[model samples]
Target: MYSRFFSLMGGLAAILSVSGGFGLSDVHAAPRDRDDVFFRSVAGVWKGPGEIVAGKYKGTKFTCDLTGEPLDDKQTGIKLGGTCRVGVFSQPMSAVISQKGNSYEGKFLDGAGGKGLDITSGQVSGDKVVVGINRAKLNGAMVARVSNDNSMNITISVKVADQMIPVIGVTLARDIDQIAVGSIKP
Candidate 1:
């Protein structure tokens, strides 16, 4: 069951570009063996796959991506994707996050033009990442690692709905494999 759940969470991370955002470690600019960062900066593009862990769609497939500009030194943009079951959902997601600071705050767009989902509690450490609603019921986490060769491995635990049931376990290494930093010039 844990293996199945982890697989699903890893898929969700891909669908969500779960690795894209601000607040990246100083490791971004530091002289680490890896030369680039996936989620920081003005314009960046990443592609990965995610899975469905609940409902009829459990263990399904989806494609996720992020595109946006830098505001107030923060990352802001549209995160939208395709679900094998559902056609499309667009989230106006933004993260005014600080990596070394241990906290992040942002909102998820409900659709193309509805209200946004408030992300009130967000935090990340070297290996753990979490986000949730303010006083409501919603949360998700990813335990991640990046090797010197620019490979990232992440595991996720999510608080599903009002039940707060942690549905997924630690995920195995799903390659969010590559990142295209800066603009996507047409």
Candidate 2:
């Protein structure tokens, strides 16, 4: 189950890279604005359950615990780390996102070995963020939207052959208890 899920994710990342026209270009940093605001709003710990909506692992359920933290004073960059568990199996996932102007660039590490997936292109519009991922033989995209101050939905999709397949769909809510205790900033 773990292997299949990661494989699909990796493939999706690759596809996203190609489609987004991302290359080995230098990245420039900027200040707070719409993108920064969006990132900051999502900063904190979120926990929820999700399921594989398509492909080989369809119907498989998993629980995810993710934390997003600002990497700079400007809040233009964020480092997210977390884990997803299915039954007794677990997988670690991490991503570093940086915004410049209205665009975003970053890297995603599945923590299942191998190199990080390149987030070639991304944009923050209103309460939504969409990023493209690319790795060797894998390509896909991730979409995240803040439904409210405390809730968000995320979906990942990868290209398989000529078809785009949905791989993961999860809804996460800000961990209220953790917030109240001041363990993580809201």
Model 1: residue 21 alpha-carbon error in angstroms: 8.9
lDDT of 1 at 33: 13
Candidate with top TM-score is 2
- Per-residue CA lDDT of model 1 for 138-180, tens digit only, reads 3454444443222234444456554443333222222334344
Residue runs of model 2 more than 4 Å from their true location after superposition? 7-32, 110-116, 160-163, 180-186
- Model 1 scores worst on lDDT over the 10 consecutive residues at 33-42
Give the Cα-based TM-score of candidate 1 against the true structure: 0.47
Task: For candidate 2, write residues 54-143 as lDDT tens digits.
Answer: 876789887767777767875476787777677998767677777755667767674224556777778755555677777777777787
Q: Candidate 1, which segments miss by more than 4 Å at Cα?
A: 1-24, 27-43, 74-102, 110-116, 134-186
Per-candidate Cα lDDT values, in order, are: 0.37, 0.62
In model 1, the clashing pairs are 11-50, 11-51, 12-51, 23-99
